[model samples]
Target: MQNKLYLDQRSNAFIILNLLMLWGWWMLYQLYALPVHYAKPYFALDKIPLYLEWSHLWFTTWLFVLLCICYLCTCLLLPHLQVAQVSVRWTLILSILGAGILNVMIYPVGAVDLFYYLTQIKLFAYYGENPYLTTFWPTYAHDELTPLSSFLSWPLVYGPAWLGLASLPIKFVGFDDLLTMLLAYKLFSLYCLLGCAWLIFKLLGGGAPGWYGAYVFAANPLVLFEAVANAHNDILLTLILLVALLGLRHRHILALPAFALAALVKVFILPLALGFAVALWRTRWPFRRIVGGSLCSLLIVFLLVAPFWGDGSIIERMQAAVEQQQTLRTAAPISLANEYAQTSGASAQQLEQLRIVFTASYGCLVLLALFFVRPLEHAMASIMLLLFLLVSSLFPWYLIPVFALLALHPRRLELGYMVVASLTGLLYYPLGVVAWQTEGLTLFQIQLVGATLLALPIVVFLVALLFQRRVELDQ
Candidate 1:
């Protein structure tokens, strides 16, 4: 009886901890987050400033660091605080409630990428302009609401499916009010993320591990901040990718269109589809059926994306992607390499050569993973990790899919996920943009930070690998 009572007490404590964490997150957002244009037009909470002063920005940055530490600590605490089997459903329920509450808060706390999304949706919804062909820069002069157009003035970098899905808010809510549009977009993102969590729970068979995984993702500070507060479309992209992977497991025909749609959202997942397709083809399934299913999937994808196609716009889109990649050397290893060369007084030609080598090498690594990695899940995780490590720019939210993948098998990648997610938040330093613009942080310093953030997990992973190999050898 005492032992049962002890377990009950622990379960109650766990429930309390979950609610406390949710409330803590709410407080942090209310007190520390910088104001963005998304909420500036709507409800103004007097406690929160309309814009961040220098002191507030600095405080917010430090508070963000503290919150990340708290987040990781909570994750570590959860395993020991498991609730009763009956209470398992409460985990997902509270997570949904927390997400909804945060979404309704209407403040763009951690990121400004939502503005870029807003601009993209507005371009298509209001002006009837092709986002792929027309740059937002031309429209910026006339639309005062579309702030930060200068930062993302390039042509459409996202895929057609993402463009279509993300633009739904503007269609229904209309772009006349920033607050309404922001709310609609965030609510949609909330729905997508919940869908992802649900699928994860279902895929994991609703066991203890599955429930824990669902809660881990559903309540993760990064997920709540990125998926709810900042409202990144990567959440939607990851959802579709997960659907495709699940379909592949079940041998469902939707796998093809799902994969195609995922590619249309991000385009990075397309290669993984090729890799998994090869695996599927090698299965005992009939060759003709496989071929027919593949053709039908492709046909549906083409039909869905056909409306966005224009005469000779593919080349334009490709050029835009290349140019954008070339300009962005923010958080990836290639960026570090280029910064190293520049600091060493290398010429433009030398930097260009370095870019070519790194880019090609990155491509080769991805292709190898696509071809060699077995089991579609492992292949997807490998490719996503490669992208996270190699991409020229980085954001904490970019790791959402990675964390989702890691939820399946948490033993190996858990430490790496925690490290990357927490450290990447350091990129949210106050005045980072100003520092970069004014060269306050020299090229070498920025490179050093980026390198550290990328290298830590990699070093840990390598060390773990070597240790495992040594254990096997000894055995």
Candidate 2:
């Protein structure tokens, strides 16, 4: 009885800690408002005050510490609470909802991608301009919300399904009111986040595992910060992917159309769709049925793209956007290689060759996993992790879907790596703030540090796994 009481107290403390950390993050994001305002038009980090830099560093570090504690508590205490019949699941739901609300209120200081999403929706829905064909700048230079976006020159890089789904809330909120529009998008993302959690719970067959998986995705600070606060559409993509997976689990033919819809949100999901096809085949689905499913998927894609297909320039614009993204050297192994090439005076052709090699290797590994990995969820999780490591351009929010996938089949090693990667990946932002202010802190230096941070988790996980194996062998 005493132990039960003690377990209940720990569970309560965990809930309180999670809420407090989220509130702390909300407060920390508020500090970015002035800096964001000053850095408008391009969102460049130039001429920031020394005091603001120090404050950002201190506050970001403290928040991260709290986030680590929250994650650890979830990992260690959740199962115990479940055993004690502490009503922890309901508490988790309330805490997640509270966190979502707080995050929606916070400024999107982490990434200004939310502004770009709004601009695209406005261009398409309000101005009747095809976002795929038109750039945000020069065309809409005088618009009030133009200055808020950082991607001034890029056309629509997102898929049409995303545009179609994202347009609804902005239209309802009235695009003329920017604040309300922002709120609508944030709320939309929050809904998607919750939807992903619900699907995960349902997929896992509702019990301790289901609740744990739900909490893992819903309560993750990285998901809250990126999906709710920054309002990235990745959460929506994840939601669609989960829907597809759920359908597939039930052996429903509609899974194909759902997978197509998910792919239409982001082209990267094509590999997962391919994996889904393999799964269908392995299950001895009839050839004619597979063809019919494929047709349905293609039909859905056509319907989504038909409205945006203007004069065939949308294709060219999409290709251009892909090329533009390829040119960027960001947080990934390729980014580190690019830094090396610059310092070594290596030919650009060499770097291109390296990228091609990585791309090919990713394709091969994905094919192997599709054929060999048992259960579609594990295959999807492996594919997502491969994309994170092997893709030329990586972002922290890309891992949002990874958490959702991992939730479907929670393994300690993969989950721990993701948790660590999320933490280290986000270090890029605060590090950028300080890098801009401190003398001699170049972008190359930052990339190098980022690479090291990303690699640490892999090393630690590998070592721990090896030690565990050795112990088992001895036993």
Residue pairs in clash, model 2: none
Clashes in each model (backbone N, CA, C under 3 Å)? 0, 0
lDDT values for all models = 0.65, 0.76
lDDT of candidate 1 over 144-229, digit per residue (tens): 55544335567878887898888886689887877677678888888888888888877777766676677667666666777777
Clashing pairs in 1: none
Best by TM-score: 2
Candidate with best lDDT = 2
Worst 10 residues of 1 by lDDT: 41-50
Clashes of 1: 0
User: How many angstroms is residue 186 displaced in model 1 relative to the true structure, after the best TM-score fit?
Assistant: 0.7
Which portions of model 1 show Cα errors greater than 4 Å?
32-70, 73-84, 103-106, 281-285, 363-376, 412-416, 423-440, 462-475
